[model samples]
Target: MAATVTPENPRTSPTISRSVTHTVNGSHKFVIQGYSLAKGMGVGKHIASDLFAVGGYHWAIYFYPDGKNPEDNSTYVSVFIALANDGSDVRALFELTLVDQSGHGKHKVHSHFDRSLESGPYTLKYKGSMWGYKRFFRRSLLESSDFLKNDCLKINCTVGVVVSAIENLQLHSINVTESDIGSHFGALLDNMEGSDVTFNVAGEKFPAHKLVLAARSPEFRSKFFDGLDVEQQEIIVTDLDTKVFKALLHFIYRDTLTEEVDEVSSTTSSDFLISETLTAKLLAAADKYGLERLRMMCESRLCKDICVNSVSIILTLADSCHATELKSVCLKFAAENLAAVMMSEGFESMKENCPRLQSEILMTIAGCEVDSCSAGEKSQSVWAQLSDGGDDAE
Candidate 1:
């Protein structure tokens, strides 16, 4: 049997809500220049205007001078609204009106609303299909009325598009514990079973899989498979300690550093701190192997652990590795604690090793001092002030 324990203060689940709605209207005016002549010459003859877009679909207005059906030929004029694009099953409302040009505002309207008042808008299933009255108006009556003016007839079509609202629900549940696959890989690394390649780092040998190393590091890939001889098995790694190399391999196999670093600190000593020294070395190694994510992780840890004792060394390391964000953090920290930092040996090391970074530090300190001084206060050079305070008691 397994034991289960509940927390004293259980967290509540979070809720999320969403809603959206949109409507678009497009109007097209179709003009017939010689209305009397066109009506006299046509039965089963129609004219189509240029295609237009509305609500992400193409449409056109079709005008038949004579009635579309032979039953109503020479008696009524027909008009229709058509879908022109390759769209399927589009639901929309349509209105076709013959404008009364005499300014009486007595326009004739034929709409989907008049036919289906209880139901909803009409659905268009395919292209080249239409919806309207075949016998829209009597040809003689329309010609005599204000609908035809100066031998021209104007027809207006309005389409009102309704975009349906979309709603989504997201449940925010409590944190549930789960198994970590990285721990299993870490266990495999610890066991060192079925190893194919050996790396000798500062006189300590580390056995690792060639495939795993190549997958993790491009430098390892080229050295192991592209450039080096196939029979070459042993690689000697210099300028890096056994601990740092072990941590790098641990990251390659396990994809994490938390457990590996913790285990290393425990084995070495309870008081052994995971110092900026180790992190800086790891960051350098990560950059060399093109492990950008690992480099960023190391930079994040180093940024949080910045202090008076470690800021200078970390700043130099950041400059060397081209870690821009970490470099900015270090510069700010150093400028704030300039007096104490300048007295440290790490600062002296930076001054000797990276003069360009030293110049950047001076500029940052000057900028900070300039920002602090108000317009009423007398301006003093930051370097002059720092020089005068050298070796002075805090």
Candidate 2:
């Protein structure tokens, strides 16, 4: 056997080949309103979901209300996923879910994720190629189920395209997460390992780094300019409330509102969710420090709190703080509910101290097309008071 061996040609370079297939996945929800009305739309007629893309190909969900095949009568409804573009030989996995509206989390699902296919992923040979059931659900059973709520039905679809790339001896891939520099800075504030300055605010003190404070606020930067004498300088703040100053420091370091500053949203809470007095004070501090973002945040939070009870007080704050957007919202809200607002204690307080605001309210209710100052009226003109004394003089 050794004597009968033939010589073979030798190759110069080493090479490797690999073909990897994976799916690019996406999900879409399609809601059918007036479900009962759609029930009689004849056989083979389908309602399609809005086109959504996955793996650079267009797809849609088609729902047959009165069954796809006439032989099955109207007993069942059909669901299918069809290739929406003019592509050929596409492979995919499909899943259909009927959401339960009863809040019991009992969703009806037919999924490819849990099943094993012997021949692999389903292939769509042409543009109209589809994969689904002719009898997706029994019509009678589905109509009476918790899947239908308020004459509406919701269907969720998941599609996975099996045409991804292959990698051979590729370099390592790294997943970069979202930036969390604020939290680290926040931790630095908490530990106070090398705190250089202290703020004495209303008999309470907060120790913080001078550089961080200077970077966050121009007012703090101006204070630190020209170099200081003391290594750990203690600055006295007389005007701010203790809690307000604390919250302001937290905002300066953390770039977020404290737990005391709740979003005063009607959707989140029926009553004013934010500590109104505390946040108003915070806004004043933000304005004084040239923190525009923090000032706007405070304005936005307070705007959601506008109602008859708080509108007058909020409007006064808005005018004083120069929160134009919040002021506009408060004025509109107050004008729309003038009667209720006038009956509130906050409104009476506004009438006594903020007569200018009362005049602005009247202008808003009168549908004044221009600003009072620009409408040929002096900026400092005293507004007329409608009183019984005028009639007595007559």
Local accuracy of candidate 2 as per-residue lDDT tens digits, 114-216 = 6736557888888878888888889989989999899998999999888766566534557899889889989998898799888898878888988898898
Give per-residue lDDT, candidate 2, residue 132. Answer: 85
Over all chains combined, what TM-score does candidate 1 have? 0.45
Among all windows of 10 consecutive residues in model 2, the one with the lowest summed lDDT is: 378-387
**lDDT, candidates in the order shown:** 0.76, 0.80
Model 1 collision count: 0
> Deviation in angstroms for 388 in model 1?
8.3
Give a tens-digit lDDT track for model 1, residues 1-394.
8545459656657666677644577889887777877775567688787677888888898888887878745588889889998777887788999999999999999876565567677788899778887889988898789999999888989886657775666674477777687787677778888778888988888988888888889988998889854467788888689888988987888787754442122123221143335676788998899998889888887776666666777788888887878999999888877888787777787778876666567668666432343411322355666778775747
Using all chains and alpha carbons, the TM-scores for the candidates as numbered come to 0.45, 0.50
